[model samples]
Every structure is written in C-alpha cells, then in structure tokens.
Target: MGPDLWNANYDELLEIPLPKQVQLTGFADDVAATIVADSAEETELLVWSTIDTVEDWLEQHRLKLAKQKTEMVVLTRQKRFPKPFKVDIGETTLTSTRALRYLGVMIDDKLSFREHLESACIRASKTVSSLSRFLTNTIGPRTKKRRVLLEVVHSILLYGAEIWADILKQKTYRRKMAAVQRRGALRVTCAYRTVSEAPVLVIAGAAPIDLLAFERAKLYNAKMNGDNSNEARARLKKETLCEWQNRWTSGEAGRWTERLIPDISVWLSRKHGETDFYLNQLLTGHDQFNAYLFKMSLHPTPTCKYCPDKIDDAEHTFFECDRWKDYRSSTEEIIGARLSPRAW
Candidate 1:
C-alpha cells in the first residue's frame, strides 16, 4: 500500500486509549511513545503494553516489528537509576541506551547534543579532506568549490540545526563548527593557513557558521509560528548580516580586509566577482607581501623589496609601490577609476 494508506492504518493506534500519563506520536512508519511513572516497573509495564498494541496493529497489516532495530532511552536529570530498565519484545530484551540516532540526529538521554555536534564535525571534516584533493590553494574554480562546501558540507553540518542550534552559544561547540568552516574558507579563498578566520571568511563572502545556524533556527521558529517564509528569511538575513558586520568591525583580525571591503553587505551583493589567486592575495594580505612574511616570521623585514622606504603590504603593493605602479595605472585607466578602497 502507499504511505498515505499505511499512515491512515497507523492512525488507529492513536485511537486506542493510552493512559493519562502516556502519549504516542508517529511520523511515517516510525512510532515514538512516551510514558511517565514513579518507578522502573511501572514504566516498563506501560512500555510493554504500548509495544503490544503497536505489534498487534503491525501484525494486522501483515508487517512485523524489527526488534533488533528498536531503541529506548530514558531522559532524567538524576545521577543514578535504582534499577536497570528493560522490556521484552518477543524473544528479544530491549534496554535503555545513553544515546541513539533518531532521524539522522544523534540524541542523547540528557539532550546535551555534544555527541551530535562532534559527529557532524567529523563528517564535515571528512568532506573537507575529500574536497581537498580537487580543490586546493592553487587549483580549482573558486566559486564551484565554495558552492560544494556550502551545499554539501554545510548541509551535513547543519542538519537539524533548528533543534540543537542553541548549543552554539557554548564556546567549545562554536569552535568545533568554526573549525570546519575555517578549513572550507581556506580552500575557497586560496589563503595561507596562517590567515586568521575572520579575513578568510570575509574574503570568501561567507557568514559565520554559528550565526548562520542561529539564522536557520530563527527562520525555523518563524515559519513554525506561521510567519511568511520569504519575509522571515529576509529579516533574519539582514539581522545576521548586521551581526557579522559588527563582529568583523570590532575584531582585531581582518583589519586589512575591513579596509578593502568595509561594507559587508555591498561586498556580498556583488553580482559578478570571483576570488582568484591575485584577488585573494590582495584582499587577505597573505601573499608574498613582505609585511605578511615578516608577521609570519618568514621574512627579515617588512620593508618593500622595490621601494625600501615603504612597508610592502597589500595596500602598498596595490596603490603606492613603484613595482606595480604601471600595471595599476593601466588597470585604473581601463576601469576609469583610481585603485582605492572606495573604488571597490
């Protein structure tokens, strides 16, 4: 039978009167029943009763419950249980687990979601490693690499974010998410590993992953409350972008990037722009520039190799250095504008 007819058949389980302290919910073929009682004996009895009813319904439909796949978890703040909780299903005995995977989300008894976050990060890191073969600091289409990172890796990491996004408020969890994004950002920007997170993200034109999770959560809540999806998403985007901008401005890192693209909204709104090696170098200040080399302790001094008086940073190399002055002038002439941060 089709899923609709199967669901209609399943609805009969809801009609069976559950105890006042018991509740049952179903999604497609999966059924989850919850029971509250003072003791393990009462809880097990209620659970067995519910399972019996469910098994009977399944048998009537010519289906058999998979005892091996069935899982149970008891959620409580108590440090210890007085006795082990168990329920018999046919010849198999089921026991409570500390954590279980439900609908692709790892849910622990305490609902801390630490296991889920760690699992997601591990999966995302694997994706990053796999992508590294084709996408690297010196190869691949920048935009395509970024698109894969966002659509694939990000989707994996943010699965069920609306439910567990609050965990991001914890610094430890936030760093785990950021580390995944930082690796992807490095690939996208073709930046050196020495480049900090903020500048790489700015150059990549990607929002902070934590803020994106918050935005996802907010959008989910808005849609749940019957708000217009499009309107709510737009509002959340503006708010999140504003917050990103605030962090970027206040942060000690990415000051050079901030100078180049002061207004993040403007940078993100561009219809046509790709970050290649040269552009990445200019925006991130992580190229062969003596200033960056010296900062990384790879160079003897930060002075320009061509013009010894001036420091060789992105700004000096682009605007003031005599080495690239002719190329800069020709480029400005072609664009009919001076090469300055305002021109960007």
Candidate 2:
C-alpha cells in the first residue's frame, strides 16, 4: 500500500513471503490472500490468518488498515454458519455480507447474476439515452449510429457475459437485455413504439441479446483457456475453428451456446466484417426480416414504410417490393432463371 514491497523496484530494500507461504495477490490499492481448508473452523481460522498477514504486511510498510471500509463475505452453496457468526481480524469483527464486489462484479453468496444483470442493464440504458441523439435525424452515416449502439450500449449490456453465462437462466435478467435491445432497435430504425421489433432489427442489422450473449461467452471461454505461449497461439490455424467448436460443445457452454450459434467459425470469421451491414445482418443476425422479438402492440409496427400495401420487412424491401420492380426484373434476367425472393 505504501511502496509496493513486492515490486521489483523495491525488492532489494523490502522482502516478502515466498510464493509457498500463502498465495498473495495485489494490484493498485487492493490485496488478496487465499488458503485451502478442510473444515468450517479451519476455514474460519485460515481466512482470519490470511487477513492478518495482509494487515501486518501493510503495517510493516507504514500503511494502516481502513477497518470501517473493509468487509468480507463467505462464498459457498450452503451458508457455513448463521449471519450472527463472526470472524475477527485484529479488533474488527468481520461480518458476512449478502454481496460484495470483486473486479467490478457484484457477487452474492448464492452466486446469482440477477444483481449484476440489473446493474448492467441500468448502465446500458443510461448510455443509450445519453447518446441516442446521434441516432436521430440521420445526421452522419448509418455506420456512425450503428457504432454508437454497438460500442456504447451493447458493450455495457454484454460486459463479462462470458464469465457469468448463467444469466441465461434468469428470465427477468434475460428480459432486461431483450428490452434494451428493442430500445436500441427502435433508435436504429426510427420506428414508433408500437412497431414490431422483427422488422426494426432487420433494418438495423443488429444481433439479439440471447445470441449476442452466447457468442460473447464462447469468445470469453476461448480466450481464458488459451495460452500466451507462441506455440499454443500458432496451433493449427486451418482447424482452429473446428477444434474450438468441438471443445466448446464438450463444456458447459456447449449446452446452449452451440444451439444459438450453429456455425461457430463463420460467426467468428471476417467474411462480413468488411461491411457493418453484412456483418450485422448475415452473421450476427443483427439484420432484418425476423419476427423473434415482435408483439402486435407496444412493439414496432411491421408495415412497410415505402409500400403501405405490404408488410415493411427485409424480404419485401430487398426483392418483393413494388419499388424494386425494375431491379428485380434485371436480376431475374441476369440470372436467366425465375427465382422467388423467398430464397432467403
């Protein structure tokens, strides 16, 4: 806390424990110690000892502990003891809390993600509202608006989704994500609140929350397990996708993530990356023509804006619209075959 004693710069002046004494980790202003135990009493002693070591180390370095700001939580499937039970470090009685934050994540004793999901949704919604002005009036290129939705709102919504993939289980949490996605789609398509999300998503070329979260989990798992060694990094480029998918299907993520994204490699490929439109629509399923999130009311309307007689949708806009008559005839003639626009 004072000068980092473990730091290489001060290693000569100050010495710390060898790695075997206790697993110690510190960064910035926070420090943590870990120990293994075989019983509840042993676990309590170990935790207190670990905390004491950290406190003593700080004291030696002339940094005092902030007892009032310090708190602890025991993480387990079963509450080891009642809330009244306490563990003491020095004169401070360390009480168990319902939740505590670690590395920016709010983790409760039960490990449920409801709190985290709610926090993320609130942050994302605020960001969307703050930056949504750019989405109005078509001031810049469509790509700019798309970037705001993806980089700002989407980034916050999907933060650490891979580590907490269990969020898929909570209906309320998943609904929060869906709600935010729909809001973004509304901005993207400039559709009225009563409009259906199906066409709006298609027009916006944006991926839905479920698929987006699963894809993020897949990528996160891959990065966490992969090694930094050059040999590991360079392994089998030709079959990397195949291997990754195979490995993913064997893990817990395989249970549902695989179904969400059938073609793992193609989803990860750069085939559509060159163009945001193609990327969102084709690979990410962020593009048009699906009714996955539409409701008859309180959702976006599904009527075609250009041709009021037909449903306004991706399929109609691309091929079946009266407006595309000339282009459609030329396309058929060029292909030298009569094709249904339903080929999509």
Candidate 3:
C-alpha cells in the first residue's frame, strides 16, 4: 500500500510543495520546517518503492535457488573439464575414446541418481510417518521400553511358535503362580515374570540357551541353594507384593466414588426404557465417570459444537444458549419421563 499509494500520486504530490508552502509564511524557521517535511515525505515514498522491488527480487531468487537445488545431482555429473593440451606437459595423452567413456559413465550415474533420489524420498516419508505415529502415542521414557517389549511379546504370542507364549496363556500356569507358597502350584508364566522370578523353566538338554536365559538359570540355581537367604531378599520380596496390592486396591479407591454412585442411579433411570439392562450398565458408567471434573450435578458445558462461543457451566448447558437451545430441547426428550431435570 505504501509504494502503491506513492505510484498513484508521486510526481503530482511532489510538484505541489504543500508541506513546504504550509510552513513557509515568510519566517525563516517556518521555511526550514516546510522544506524538512517535504523532503521527509519524498524520502519515505522512495524507501517504500525500493523495499517493494527488493522483496519481489528476493522471491524470484528463492524460486531459482530451489529449482537449482532440486536438479543438483544431475547437473553436477555433466562435467566440463578444462584439459588443455600442452607440449612437454607430461607423457600422458588425452584420447577421444577415454573422454567419451568418462562421459558415458557420468550419464549412467545421472540416471541412477534420479532413481536413488526417488528411493531416498520414499524412505524419508516412511521415516517421517513412523516418527509421527510414535510421537502421537505420547510415550515417555518410562513407557517406551515397556510398550516396545509388550508389542514384541504380543507379536510372538500371535505369530511365533514360542513355548513361553503357550505357557503364559495357560490358566494352570496363572493358578499355580497365585497358589505358590499358599496351596497348589504357581500359575505364573515367563510372560508374567522375568525368567529370574519364574519358578519353572522347560529346556531340551541339547538346545543352546540365550545369554539372558543362562543368567536367569544361574540366578535360579543360586536362589535354590539359599545364596540369597539374607534379610535384603526377604525385604525386596515383601515390597514387591506390597506394590502389587497397592496398585490393585488404589484402582477402585477414586475420590469421586461417592458422587459417581448417585449419578449411576440417575443414568440407569434415564436409560432404562430406551435400552437393555446390559446397555444401561455401560451408559451408566459413561454418565457417572464422564461427568464434568467427576462431578455429576455440574454438567460439562461443551463449547458450542456449532460455533465458537464457550458455554460456561452445567446450568448454561441445560438452560441458556445464544443459539443451541433448539438442539438441547430435542436431546432433553431422550431422557425417560421418570428422570426429571432436577433429579439429573
């Protein structure tokens, strides 16, 4: 706009001397100020036009650079060497056939370079896609190795003929582990525990064991001979069991348990006539736990699914809407007659 405005009025505006005339009222200081203002405006107009031209040239330069970079490999191979012939320079002589051979090799290499570029681009795309998927999983240091191992184990279970996979799947193995030191055999399998903790190891005497397996076997032998009978081992075993118990118990110890129970009641009442009991069970879980910040009474006000206006709280969602009232009315009808808004 700056340069364009200048273009429309440049010569005409400069010839007027409006700023100079406005200041020069027969006083010396006024005449000086008028000249300064006029000069400043003319300088600004010129600067704007120069900047516009520079920007256009820069854009063209970038396009040229991009095209040159894209075709660099092929261009580089088409060499024009300056091999000037001279008397007594050396015993070596340049032959036409030798030069032609070099050119032929260069041409062949250029063709191969194009194919390699395409292959490189494909590999780069695959790498980028893999990285994107990995990033999207949001896996951190703690979860990354565990997730990878889990995936490997799952793949072996589904596709490989690994004996550990079979053992891991057995109900007997789990039952045995659960009963170890209690009653029956432990139902644990290699998949559930590291080889060191697993009590059972099946081996064909002739087969070579992996390094990890060998180390595990050595540890097991040591344990059997009471090499780890010290208090430290006992403490570690106790702590492991305590950790397991805490993980199990705390899962059901959510702070909002009391609030969820009543919401489940309301959800069951609302959904009872529309769906079967099993479906109601699922929806009740959804309504209770999916409550706004785990509080059922305050329904989460969604952002206007249609527009950008943010609904503040549950009451706004239920009653006020600059535009969503009509849709909300139809949704309200879906709830059973017995479950009024107050009950909800």
Q: Each model's TM-score?
A: 0.92, 0.61, 0.15
Regions of model 1 farther than 4 Å from truth:
82-84, 88-90, 142-145
Model 3's TM-score against the true structure: 0.15
Q: Compute the lDDT of residue 290 as modeled in candidate 2.
A: 31
Candidate 2 residue lDDT tens string, 120-141: 8888888778657666633434
Question: What's the C-alpha lDDT at position 319 in model 2?
Answer: 55
Over 54-166, each residue of candidate 1 has an lDDT whose tens digit, in order, gives 78877987888888989988877555553345787679999888788888899888899999999999999999888878887767776655665656778888999999999
Question: Which of 1 and 2 is ahead in lDDT?
Answer: 1
The window of 10 residues in a row where model 2 has the poorest summed lDDT is 283-292
What residue runs in model 3 are displaced by over 4 Å at the alpha carbon?
1-311, 332-341
Overall lDDT per candidate, in order of appearance: 0.85, 0.58, 0.30
Superior candidate under lDDT, 2 versus 3: 2
